[model samples]
Structures are given as C-alpha cells and as structure tokens.
Target: MSDEVVENDLIHCIYCNAGTVRFSEADMVSLLEKAREANSALGVTGMLLYEEGSFFQVLEGPAESVDALYEKIFRDKRHRRITKIIRESIEARNFSEWTMGYAGVTRQDLKEIEGLNDFFYTKKCFTELDPGRAKKLLEAFKDGNWRASLR
Candidate 1:
C-alpha cells in the first residue's frame, strides 16, 4: 500500500490524563464540548471517562491525527500530567462514529483502583490493561461492585 493510504488508514487509540476543576453540571457540558471540538477539528474519535477530580480519556483516529491531538492535549493547561497509555496501529476503529463520546464515572466506579497505589496517575498501568480485563473491571463497577471492593 502507498504511504499516504497507510498513514490515513491506520487506526489507534491512546489514553490520556487530566484534572477537573470541579465536577459540576456546567463542567460536564464544557467537557463534552471540548471533546467534540477536538474530535471535529482533528478528525478524531474516542471515549472519555471522568471521575473523582481526574480525567481519563481515550483518543482514536488516524495515526497522525491522534498523535497531533495528543501533543496539543499535552500542552493545554486545562489538563496536566499528560501521559500516553497506549498507541497501536489497528485495522479498525473501536469508536467509529463518536466524535467524542463522554461518560462520567462516580466514586463507585473507581473501587478497583482505590487501594492499588496511584494506578490512575500511572499511565503505564492503563496501557497494560488488556481490553478484556479493562472491560471486566468496568463491568464490575456497573454491577454494583463498589462496596465489594472494600471486602
């Protein structure tokens, strides 16, 4: 394949970190807007999970666009301590239609990582999380495993 096609067709998802000023209703709207704007401008797609006072976001798109967006995100003061979780060129987009899908995770959703050191602060752990394991953990949260984590 030609290099142009190779570059444009490559799919990748990268996780990122940011801090929240306040988890208010207005903040939620602004975040959704920011994601949409970023995705539209960069032709990116991905999911965002916000919890506690931190931000955990994923950006998926053509390899080049994703990388560029990541660089921009790193420099933005609205978010800090930027780290890359993973960057693999895949064959398909996991979040195809989402310009910037957003989700707000509560304290309940963070039970798994609560006592596991600073897992959230360390991007490497997120990168190492296989999709299945990540999904299982998330499912546990959704299934009301919040209290169970303390046991």
Candidate 2:
C-alpha cells in the first residue's frame, strides 16, 4: 500500500480493540488532551469512544499522518487485539471539526447507543463488527445521536 499522502486525498481508518491495561478517568483525560494536540498538528480528525475498557475510533486525514498515528497506537502497549473495521479514501470527513472528539460511554448509555448494546451488555467480548455496522456506530456518535438518544 502506498504511504504517500497527497494533500487532496482524504483517508479514514476505523478500528477497535480492548485495552490491555485499565485506564483511570484521569489517565483517559490526559491521554485525550495529548492526542488532540498531536492530531491537530498532524491534521487528523476523528472520534474516540471508550466503554468498559474497549475503544472504537475513527481517524481521518492525510494518509501519511493517519498511518503514523496508527503505528504509534499499535505499539502503545495499551491497546490489545486491534482489529480494523474499515480503511478507505473519502471525499470528506465525518468529524472535520474536531481534532479528536471523544466520549466515555457509561452503562446507562450503552443500551441507547443503537449498535453497541451487545458490546457492553456482553462485557466487550466479541470479534470485529461488520464494517458498515461499525461505520454506522461511529457516525451515530459523531453526529451527536448517541448522546441525544441515550440521554
């Protein structure tokens, strides 16, 4: 695959995984702050959703920058069993406004997040979700449906 990142091409990569080590609330906040700063400088836009030690993320931007960030994530020693849900070039971004929008979904919100009921209800034990389904789930959160519908 070409690692070249043409300025005009926008690429998005979505993935999910369970954490190898638990992150405290403070740890999550600090991590998000660092990620937003780094991703902003790199022109990356995405959303990160964490629930019950599992993470679902969608990162979109120049190919080179997204690839570099994924490389670091793969080696972070925190994420385990990473499985990519989708990777493709797109004309636009779903999260163009946020460097890294994030939400830490709680148990009460799980049942109302549309596609994530099983994930949290079942204790985050499962294989990869279908690509389209995964995309919908990400979009739902990115579009503020998760918060509105859940609350």
Task: For residues 6-55, write the lDDT of model 1, one tens digit per residue.
Answer: 33466565554545355687877876787688688877876666665566
Each model's lDDT: 0.59, 0.77
lDDT tens digits by residue: candidate 2, 1-151? 9764445778999888855567898998899889999999999998887776788788999988998898899788887898887888987777777788887776667556677677657665324567866866866776765634321
- Worst lDDT run of 10 residues, candidate 1, spans 142-151
Local error of candidate 2 at residue 147 (angstroms) = 6.0
- Going through the candidates in order, what is the number of backbone clashes in each? 0, 0
Among these predicted structures, which one has the highest TM-score?
Answer: 2
Q: List the residue pairs that clash in candidate 1.
A: none
List ranges where model 2 is wrong by over 4 Å: 1-7, 115-127, 147-151
User: What are the models' TM-scores?
Assistant: 0.64, 0.82
Residue 80's lDDT in candidate 1: 64
